[model samples]
Target: MDNILMKNEKFLEKQRTYTYTGYNLTIHPHKTPEVYIDFFEFILKEKFFLSTGFRTYHLALHDLNYLDVNNKLTGLYGSLVRYENLLPSQFIDLNTGKTPEDLKLNIASNIKYKPTFFHFIFFPENHKIIFELENERSTISYNVVLQFFKKILDSDKFKVKFTSGEVHTLTSFKRVNSILKNKKLKHIEFLVSRPNPDIFGDLVDETISEYLEDQKAKNMTLTLTAQDGKYLDLNDNTEKLGVAAAENGEVKAVIENSNNRTEEISTKKFPLNHPQIFGKSVTIRNRLLMAAEKLLPKNKISR
Candidate 1:
């Protein structure tokens, strides 16, 4: 961790993640939105968003504007996500002497990792999108998490990882930073030991295909570590989990011989909304998101 991050004691305690929960959204567009990336930049250029209700966020090519797939407003990527009270607050850009708007609302956390959703993914190097989902239970949804990664593969944006001049590395936060900066999925508990002998290869391949679909890539090696069990079916549940991920993607089939087993970790995926439960445990954290967002602009964290 950077010394600056260390100095921010709270950052380390939370593993560089502050709690952000509410009925937020992780918008997955079925069709590209009419407002393209360039257009988004043009609109927000020279402006800033005083964040209103989310905890954390990051940006990709643009400072704070990420264009969702096809540019449509919002859609659930996978079957489900960490469907807790997590939500991201919204804000918009305003001049130094002006105030910004606050946009906070409920958004279902249903995007999950699955096999069937590989149809429209675009994996750009360092830009693989993920679709983790939450369910009725309080626990996180690992199956939905798989669906999230699968959706990223469908986006065809994964190629950005190897687009010449695009230096890549697993060690550097560059790759995953966009997701984090954009508040796509924070509190990601990266596995200490990755399990490479796993069959999630299909998921990775799917991401590669979408990323490299229209254009040629630098043919770079995506430096990924198969964390022993973070995204694996640790309870010898690969076949079952794989089937679930696939089903969530609209693949209405079960694991034919899903007996094959593997070890993976469990991750919780879901969209966040500020003022989302405001449970006793997260009251202080909620205050932080609201206060920081007030400093920034609402609607600034748009993808």
Candidate 2:
């Protein structure tokens, strides 16, 4: 028999351990190894970790070409991979014999199974007005939703009216609520059957501008459900909305026919966890990077 060594002893000895999110990950050939072998070994380790611990590991691919390689690795184990500037791609177990595209479709189907809820909170004095909008038919754009709310806020019909022996409309919310304190009317309800309807189109922009300027009502919380059914607090100053989850599932905003009309766009059930604002489509991937940046420490993240 011939003495044949498949593994390099020096390379194996040089394995380096790195800490990410309190997890210790060991990388083989600490310095640098053949790209194929390095990625293969990394995938194997990730598989082992996931099976035993069931935690997601973040792997940063410095080169764009590695995306193709990562796609290939999906054959070994099917885990969700959120690549840079790419759609949320998936890799599945080899036994399933399913392609990444198939996994994507499966994910899309799962997203459609559940309804999404957008929760908003407005604080007026000691009272907190909570509004939860449900969408079961189609996705609605955040701008359009904001516009809808703006229309309601600016509408005289929805405004606080004093009918006690006199018909008077109060400009200040605080004053109106004070007079109607005993009425216990805090929430205003509206029905939105369509996105960016012609009814509230006029008051959309103006109300958003006024609402943004109002210091008293500035303390508002906006939360949107993610594709995973977990609510992501989008009101974070850094995580402003470009595209977000809607009642039905997730909704995107896009310009229609180069016209000023903005439309709410939804595709089957593909929920965009993080979407960036592009020309007419919300297909860009910068939003995911921004989200990762906010979640991970500054020193731990790389470009």
Question: lDDT for each of the candidates?
Answer: 0.26, 0.24
TM-score of each: 0.19, 0.16
Against the correct fold, how does model 2 do in TM-score? 0.16
RMSD for all candidates, in order, please.
Answer: 19.7, 25.2
Name the best candidate (by lDDT): 1
lDDT of 1 by residue, 94-188 (tens): 46443344545545323322212111111121122222112112323233333333333333343242111111111111222222232112122
TM-score of model 1 relative to the true fold?
A: 0.19
Give the clashing pairs for model 2. Answer: 78-91, 78-92, 78-93, 135-247
Residues 126-214 of candidate 2: C-alpha lDDT, one tens digit per residue: 11112222222223333233333233334343233211110111012222122122122222111111111111223432343244335
- Can you tell me which runs of candidate 1 are displaced by over 4 Å? 1-137, 141-143, 152-215, 222-303
**On a 0 to 100 scale, what is the lDDT of residue 191 in model 2?**
15
